[model samples]
Target: MSVLRPHGSAFSGRLGWGRAPAVVVVDLVRAYTDRDGPFGLPDPEPAVAATQLLVDAARADGHPVVWTVVRYAPGLADAGLFVHKVPALACFGEDAPGHWGELTLKPGAGEPVVVKQYASAFFGTTLASTLHGLGVDTLVVAGVSTSGCVRATATDALNYGFRPQVVRQACADRTPALHDSNLADLDAKYADVVDLPEALAHL
Candidate 1:
């Protein structure tokens, strides 16, 4: 009863599952998880919890854990095309309280937190270098907006020579239909869309 279909391509079915795998939790900030925040589209708490579970598992297994959150500079004029396309996210402006929330990790602590500005966590960020430095050959991707940031990050992960394993239940979109549709397409062309439990069990 899995929703994934075989994707025949170079990036298809080539995930090095047993390789040096790491978990990348993208944009699980309070602004996106809060149901009432401007950037909040739907209830992403379940996805956040699922992601935290994966993070815990990865940490226990000695795999690298990386967290990404969107950060903006002071002044709306400095915002990029993403902010222009989705003006609602302006609420995450610099110094906004919305940006201050309980991220996956506490500040000044364990794993490095990569601050991103666009949909893809890899864009203009140290994610690639960090993963490469860690010898990460596979990525366990879990985060919000299945059709947006998650999809973009998975695609780029493949291009960057990392196997992208997207946990289905660990990702959510504004609409359930959108979430399902993106997961299907991702399975068909981008990454292996596996349920969180099944993926963890296999791992």
Candidate 2:
């Protein structure tokens, strides 16, 4: 690997893909996907597009697919401290418009949709146990706001004993600086930051 920035010392290595892998698409709802919405951005589409390929690959390979969505209660009762940090998150309320609370990347009927109140799919959710029940040993993590949800999920995957393969192209943020930095740190310590093709090929 080319060294763009130096790590003080080696603290991590590639966990790689396991035989049983599942794809978890995190927070690609319309609120973040549509340019007219509050958290929307132009560059997130590429990540969404890349993730679509991984989803297809996972389905074809007969692996389970899980999609995570962030939806706050009517009064933002479950949003916790995040609501105070980013008031724009209120736009993801259940009453948000069709193009706001909806998922940009639609899931198949059999695929599971895990609604979350926070960033990481694992945080205060049945995600970890669900994956365990499905015998999913590796997590193919892809989704929006790479610096937030993507990074959080990847880190949590490591802690939860599941190998997280974070597709670099299948993860995005409002700013490239945030996306790049988070992925760099995740690669150095938590997950294997890989290209879309590389991840798909492995799966």
Candidate No. with top TM-score: 2
Models 1 onward score TM values of 0.87, 0.92
Q: Residues 84-136, candidate 1: write the lDDT tens digits.
A: 78986676667666554346344234787888788888999999999999998
lDDT of 2 by residue, 11-34 (tens): 667797888999999888887888
Residue pairs with colliding backbones in model 1 are: none
Which ten contiguous residues of candidate 2 have the minimum total lDDT? 92-101
TM-score of 1: 0.87
What is the model-wide C-alpha lDDT for candidate 1?
0.79
What are the lDDT scores of the predictions, listed in order? 0.79, 0.88
Cα deviation of 109, candidate 2, in Å: 1.7
lDDT score, candidate 1, position 99: 57
